[model samples]
Target: MHRHTRRTVITTLLASSFALSGAVALAPSAGAAVPTASCTVTPNASGTSVTIKGEGFTAPRNLNDGESTVPLSVDANGNFQVTRFQKNVDYTVLAVKEDQNFTFVNCKVVKAGDTSGNATGNNAKDAKRGAGDGYRAGRSAAQKSCDVKATPNKNQQHSDAYWKAWQTGADAAFNRYC
Candidate 1:
């Protein structure tokens, strides 16, 4: 009876060890491929803001524009968007995931009223252009705490659309930043 009990104990120990080894073998390796992300940049007709749409990024991502980083959450479909990004300058937009994996794309904001097309679209384009210009001016004004001298762009100062958008932008910026 003693011999039988000892053999049973040894067999149980060997079986447990084998099971543990198998589990380790089935685990994911450290070298597994990291997820990738891709994005498309669409600058509004008015060059003031850009909409960045991305796919294949993991949850809890960040959009970095060199000067600042904005945290973003990927939706269930693994997609995200950064709407109304205010920087007008051209730069590389970096999308970084929580795991330190990242991807990037260059974005170019078109100058206001620079679109190439027929003459009839010029009016609408001009309005958008004016809005873009106004937004930039307003942001500048707000940055100066709305106390800066009015250095209006001679070309855009005449347009009603420009003034309207400029006021809107200034108000928005002042509310947010100042």
Candidate 2:
């Protein structure tokens, strides 16, 4: 009787362990991949404000508001992740960057893949731009281009389209990172 009781107890334990393992195996993974942005912030002595710097900052443009400068989104590598998310039910996150001279703002609006942990859509041209002084120089160049584009009667239709596209991508970046 003792042997039989021991056998029954062992069997029950094994069954319970197997059940638990199966449940765990069937459980859902962390479905969404966390979107990461590369940014370097230099804090002041009091830590109240920071000098935020990154690449892929572009000017915003619209029919009424033409060529206003704003910070574009970046990926894990600090390159501008230029992708648009268009779903009314999606999430929105605010990514604000400010300095003595300018402020870069992005309100990231999420899309299906943006939250799925498997989405891959970043502008290759904007990626791999460098950090630190190189970043500043590149940013200056980009701002210069924007400034040039913003000039009165100097507009190209394709240039306008590009700026508009950059402005649209801010929604996804702000949602994912900010």
Candidate 3:
């Protein structure tokens, strides 16, 4: 009985030590930092141009402006800047980092210098509504065998937001139907 008790205590101590070591091994190291990314867009030239600044991104960064993707250069501190980025419509800018990690920010380029703080939301709503309307119109044009084009008419009296949205909708409709 004495021998068995001694053996049991020894086994328990060994098992406990092994479990503690395993947990320590599995713990994350203090230097194992998580990757991060961010971006900001500044409208320029009445929304015709934009300056995008980004930080916390690794090398091989790229900027995706909903319409095109352009490679970017990063400084030693993992920051990037894109100046004079041409843009006509409001854009959802994406900052892509290594290994497909990315972050996105919406830029309201159409309403330049509008500091109302509601421009982004309002523009999004307008774009949504315009897309819907354009889609419907495109469907109708397809049914009527009319040319479905997204080109804005100079004579049409519509808000820039609305017209841009309409063009997008019409173009999408044309692709799907015509």
Candidate 4:
């Protein structure tokens, strides 16, 4: 009876190990890929107030809010929480992977009113270009370019279609990154 009990235990352990190994196979190979990271950024009454909630901040780093970067301190237990996010801007997580030596983009930060609502779109970015320093270093340049079409052999020249396409991409990029 004792021998039978020991044999049963050993068989069960072996079978479990095989099942566990199979699960590992389902996961990406070591250093071949970065673990998919995810997070959510919540803001307080103040737009600048933010909290970052997620996992895998292996080595705590900084989070950027377009205008500046802020240091992010992760808890010893691997929990990360921040208390300030830029108002009306996009934010994202940038972290270095323990393996693969690549930065993992677990998620992007976003807020309403970051982009323009115009059919032409980019009206916000263009406004930002004029209202503040962007693209051409300030709002004036962006406004001038709103009606600008290409002049052959000159810099910043493109077709109306090109500009429209650029706006589409710009909108998508902000949505994707932020």
Please give each candidate's TM-score: 0.35, 0.20, 0.36, 0.35
lDDT of 1 at 131: 56
State model 1's lDDT: 0.55
**After superposing candidate 3, which stretches have Cα over 4 Å from the reference?**
1-35, 88-178
Sorting all predicted structures by lDDT, with the top scorer first, yields 3, 1, 4, 2
Q: Supply the TM-score for candidate 1.
A: 0.35
lDDT (tens digit, per residue) of candidate 4 on 86-134:
5456666656445522254443443432221121232334434332222
lDDT of 3 by residue, 27-127 (tens): 87643424434455667655567766655566666666667777878787666667755654444445565355555545433335443222233444655
Best by lDDT: 3
> Per-residue lDDT for 77 in model 2?
42
Residue runs of model 1 more than 4 Å from their true location after superposition? 1-35, 90-100, 103-178
Between prediction 1 and prediction 2, the one with superior lDDT is 1
Q: Between 1 and 3, whose TM-score is larger?
A: 3
The Cα local distance difference test for each model comes to 0.55, 0.34, 0.60, 0.46
Which of candidates 3 and 4 reaches a greater TM-score?
A: 3
Pairs clashing within candidate 4: 50-83, 50-84, 91-109, 129-138, 129-139, 130-139
- Residue 9, model 2: Cα distance from true site in angstroms: 0.5
Give me the displacement of residue 29 in model 3, in angstroms.
7.4
Candidate 4, overall lDDT? 0.46
- The number of residue pairs in model 1 that clash at the backbone is 0
